[model samples]
Structure formats: structure tokens, C-alpha cells
Target: MSNASTSPFPLAACAEMLWRDRPIEWRASRLKELGFGVGLWNWPEHDIGKLEATGASFTIMNGYLTGRLTDDEGADELIRTARETAQIGKRLGVQRLNLHGTGLGDRGLPVQPIQVVTGVMWLKARDTLSRIVELAEQEDVTFTLENLNLPVDHPGTPFGRAEDTLALVSSIDHPRLRLNLDLYHAQIGEGNLVELCRKSLPWIGEIQVADVPGRFEPGTGEVNWNGIARALKAMGYSGPIGMEAWASGDSEEALEAFRAAFTI
Candidate 1:
């Protein structure tokens, strides 16, 4: 649990979202200097050695390169890639490895979109996550399944809603496999943010935030992030809160706004 005097939750910001023109290592180092842990997306796009040199506390990163959650072949590929990515995650000392319902492509669209998810697909997704849990246990790492917004960000993505993710993770009920409760997506897909957090508290490994209108930092848009911060503190959630948002203007100012929102 984080100390209330310092921060209500351990804070992190996505390096990929900040300083788009700067070098990745420079962004990581700057984030560290600003007292926030760093979050990463796909590892292959950047140099691991450079990231390690920055000495940032890596909070999370994408778990697999390419795979889906609702089929045998996709599940197998997911496991294999996740195993490989775990090695990189360990190398960087990343706290949580993130997963989506399926692999994302250009502009966050699902590579293999599904119009309807069948009952068998649900069963298979559950079973597949169980296998991921086994892999996580074997590798001594934690994996988080994140919910995505279908209407705006990920159209036709099956099992992309918070309700579906909560159902799956709660069913598994394993520490190695937890929910990466992304409030940005939830706010867009379903608006009862505080209530959603209350329901997801048990299975949440971490919480991600971004303002609703522009996917920018806290206080720049519609979300009452400070109120939600208080709500999370009241709910006894002392885990990582990551800012996975773009800078509306200056990146440093954006980060400061994020810090203020969750600082309690």
C-alpha cells in the first residue's frame, strides 16, 4: 500500500504517449526524474538496453506480440509469445504485463475483429486465460487483461468491455492473472466509473487513466480524476495508477496535472 502523505497510489505514465519527438530512452529518463514509473507498449519497437539504462521503474508493458484469447490456435500463439515477452519483461523488471482481447493493429483496431462472441468463445477465452496463469506462475510474473472500448477505439473486438473482463478475471480468481482496469476505456464504453472500480477492486492489478474527451491527461477533459482518486483511496486500493494518455499541450505540464489528480 502507498502512503497517503506521498501519494494515494503508485503513479506511472506511459512513455510512448509522451515526448513523441524525443528518443525513447530520453523519455524514460525524464519520466524517472519526474518521480513517476514508466509504462511501455510493444517492446520490439524500442531498444531494451536503452530503456534499462534509464533506470526507470517499469510499471507495465504489452505481454504478447500477436495472439487472440478466444481460440485454440490463437491461445497457443498467445502463450508462446507471452513466454518470450516474459523474458524481456523480467529483463526490464516490468511490474505487470498487459493483454487485450485480441492483437491490435494500426490505430488500435483489432486485427481479427469479431461481430459476435459465442458461448464457446467465452469458455475458450476463460480456459485460455487459465493457461496464461499457469505460464505466469511458471515464469514468476503477473499478467493483466485490459478492457478496451469497442465503439471508439476497438470496433468489433470481442470481450473488449469492462463487464466481460471483470467476469473472466473474477472467475479465474488468481493473483498471477489480474485485471488491468482501464478507466479511460470504461468511461467511454460504460460511464459509472466509481461503481465499476468498486466491483473490480478485488481482481485489479493496476488502474489506467486518461481524460474522456481527448484521451489526454487528467483535468484537461471531462473526468473528475481527483474525485475518483479519493474514491479509490476509500476503496483501499493502493496499487499502481498509470496515465496512459497523450499530452494535450506540453508533456511536462500534462504529467504534472496527472500527478496532481492522484496525489491525494
Candidate 2:
């Protein structure tokens, strides 16, 4: 746990990004030594028991939803998959699972403005997500909807804007459904980081960080880390902010810079 006197949010190490050459257990042990309160993991194959034994909290496994919710069968499949994921969360003693919204058209072109309009897809997705949120509530887990900025990272992802993602969460009106505000993607897709953080504070379950221009540590890119950290602190956002960036040099050096920048 982080000292409340300093940073409001604790820093979490992304297992999929740092020290990846070693086994998951080794990585978890290292994070424990480094005082990381949580580890952001994506795959299901990891040894959850080993990770837990190391004393570093881990996020629930994440994966892309295969079918579109617009069709009956697809919606059914999406709900069933969410139920299964919730079951996995319960089994692992993890409380939060992150998920991505619909991907946009093919990569390599300017994001068409029409992509933002959810249209019928919103109704279908909302209905499907409602049932999924119910399952998540029953399992005592949260599903965080991450906003992936399309033009930079996703290229053609539909739910790239913070407004659309916030609207989805608001429309769902479920306690178990929340947003995962990834600052890196948000900065690339939209420059107003602090305002978005303030507006989405109520529903934000997790926050991930990396610098823009390149997914590197805070000082390596153009993002104003000092300002962003101050804003998060001011808003009383206490969730763990994950370090999801790639290390530009020595890993320890990168971490030190992050700590110094965030003043955590």
C-alpha cells in the first residue's frame, strides 16, 4: 500500500511488460520486492497460485470479446464469455477484470468520424453488458472498460473517445461496470487529460500510464506527468495507476524516473 501522505494512487507493475523473459513467478516476486501493490496481467496461462504466493496483487486475465453483440447469437456468446470470465475471477480471488470495447474498421486510414456513433451497436452492447455486469456483481468482481485511442495505438477502434466510454458506463448504470482510463491512449486520441480525468473520476476503476509519441516511461515522451499526477491527486482518485509503458533503458532506472515524476 502507498502512503496517503504522498501519492493517492499506488503504482502497479504490468507483468506483461516488465521482466517478461523470466517466469511469471519470478516476476511477481520481483514486484513484491519493489513494493508494487498490484500486477496487471493479461493471459490466463499464468500460474495464479505462484503469483498470489509472492504477495503481489494481480488483475484478472484480459481477452478480446470475439463476437459482435448486434446479433442474438453473438450477444448470447458475449454474455456467456463474460460469465465464464467472472467465474475465473472468483476462482482466482481477483476483484477486477479489464475488457476492450469494439474494434473499429481496418487500420491504416484516418479514423472516420462516423465510427464514434454507436447506433444500434450501443443498444445491443448495452443489453449484453448489463447481464455481464450482473454476473460480475454476483462474483464480487469489476469489469473495467479501457479506452484505446484509435489513431495512435488502435488505428481504427470504435470506442476511442472518453465521452463515448463514459456514456457507455453511465448508460449501463451498474456498480460493477467502470472505466479504465489509460492516459497514454487518451493523450494520443484526445489531448485534454486532466479534464477527462476529472469528468470520469467517479467511474474510473483503474488508471494506466505511459508517455505519448512512444509508449515509454513518463519522461521519455511528451506527456506532462507532473501535471497529470497532480490532477489525479487533487481529484482524490485512489485506485492503483498501472505502469504499462515499455522501458526505454534499464528497467530500474525507468522505474525510478516514474517514481520521481509521480512523486509517489
Candidate 3:
């Protein structure tokens, strides 16, 4: 990373910490009480103002890109959800929304046939994306396409790689549609994190972080923050950095673990 200075990194919480294995409610006030910033996903619409009063801004919360594509009638549901989230976030003063680009499935060993079908699926997925972008744009929130990590335990997904993510962004060519890079997902799905971030500096809109091996904290695992952090700094990113990790313990303990990890 050839940068003269490193930008300040903001610590934020993602939905999994609050809603993965437990209730997602009460996350905002808990964060406010604990003095944390950077909203991840599933923000409480009921008390968004109070959450904002805690001096935290939303980085990127979940969106309905995929949810809108599920059923024929789901389109309306997606629009309504996005509109509501945007209104709630706007009232809370958040600027970004992160969405899972598309779905993934199993592939064979050769993977040739699978790639072809997946490519077609990804192309079809553009229709869903178009709807999402239009809604997000109208709502005044930046929509970022999050790259899938392939589940490793599952199968192949259509939009898992950086190349695929960029391809979708290029295809859509919408100002609201941009890159939402996840370090843990990239570590699991792509190669050479620093190199990839360098190559993709221009496309990245927001960065969500968690360490590798177990998606824990910085020093709690094998992820090399020294290089990635330097590369992010070198790329001149000044957006909110989020914690999109799972809580191995209770919420407070998990928050403590994350805070401890940031100290590294």
C-alpha cells in the first residue's frame, strides 16, 4: 500500500451479532448504551432517532434485492421494505444499504457446466437488481451489492467473486449500485485480498469487516489486517467500516470481543 496516511476506521455492528441466533430487537439502544457506532443491518424502525442520537451513523443495513426476487408477488414486498428502510434510515441519517447480489447453489467437480448456468442466472438476476436500484435511488440510499462467500459448506453462487460483482455493477451502470466489500467473505471466496482491494479501489463503496477462519475479530484469527488495512488506506476509502461477524457468546460479550479485536 503506497499511501502517505491511514484513514480512521469506524467500528460498526452488523445484523448477525444481534439477529443471527437471537432477537434483533434492542440492538440499537444496546449499541447506544455501549457507545458504539456503525450500523450493520436490521435497524429498529421504531427508535431510529434515538439510535442516531447515540452519535452513530448507519454504514450499511440489509436490503431486499433478493427478497424482492423470490416470489411473483414479492416485488411489492421488496419495494415496501426498501421504502420503509430508507425512510427509517433517512430519519436516522444513514446513507448506505447493502444487499446480497443473488443466490448460489451446488456445482460439480469440473464446474464448466455449472459456470455456464450460473452466468445465465446472474444475467437474469440483473432484472431483480434493476428494480432494487431504482427503488433505492428513489429512496435516497446508496445500494451496494455484497459479494457472496460461496458458503464453502454449500455450493456455487452466481455472484460470488470480485469479477462477477464488478460485472454486475458494470451491467447495471447505476450510480446507486456499487460495491460493498466484505473482508471475511473475500478471504473465504477470493484470493490475494490486498491485490484485489487495490484493483477494486474505484468500485468499492463500503467495507464490512470480520476476521477469517471463524469470522471473529482482527487478531483473534488468521486475517492479515496489516496488509488489508494498508491497502484500504492506500485506496483512499473514507466510508464507515462495519463488523459483520457472528457472536460466539452473548451480545455484550461479543461486543467486548469485537472491541478487543479492534484494539489490535
Clashes of each: 0, 1, 2
Cand. 2 TM to true fold? 0.86
Candidate maximizing TM-score: 1
lDDT tens digits by residue: candidate 1, 142-260: 99999999889899888999999999999999999999999999999998999999999999999999998889999988999999999999989999999999999999999889888
**What is the C-alpha lDDT profile of model 3 across 1-264, one tens digit per residue?**
201123355566764466454333356546655655556555543355555565554566765422433333544555666677677667667767766533221331112213333444665567767887888767777877777576552244446666677777767888888888777788887868877777666777877777777776555578867566666766776655667776655766776666554432
Tens digit of per-residue lDDT, candidate 2, span 177-259 = 88888888888888799999998988988888898877888899888898888878877877777778788887766766777
Clashes of 2: 1
- Better-scoring candidate (lDDT), 1 or 3: 1
TM-score of model 1 relative to the true fold? Answer: 0.98
Give the Cα error of residue 238 in candidate 3, in Å. 2.3
Model number with the top lDDT: 1
**C-alpha lDDT of candidate 2 relative to the true structure:** 0.69
- State the weakest 10-residue window (summed lDDT) of model 3: 104-113
TM-score of 3: 0.72
TM, every model:
0.98, 0.86, 0.72
Give lDDT for model 1.
0.94
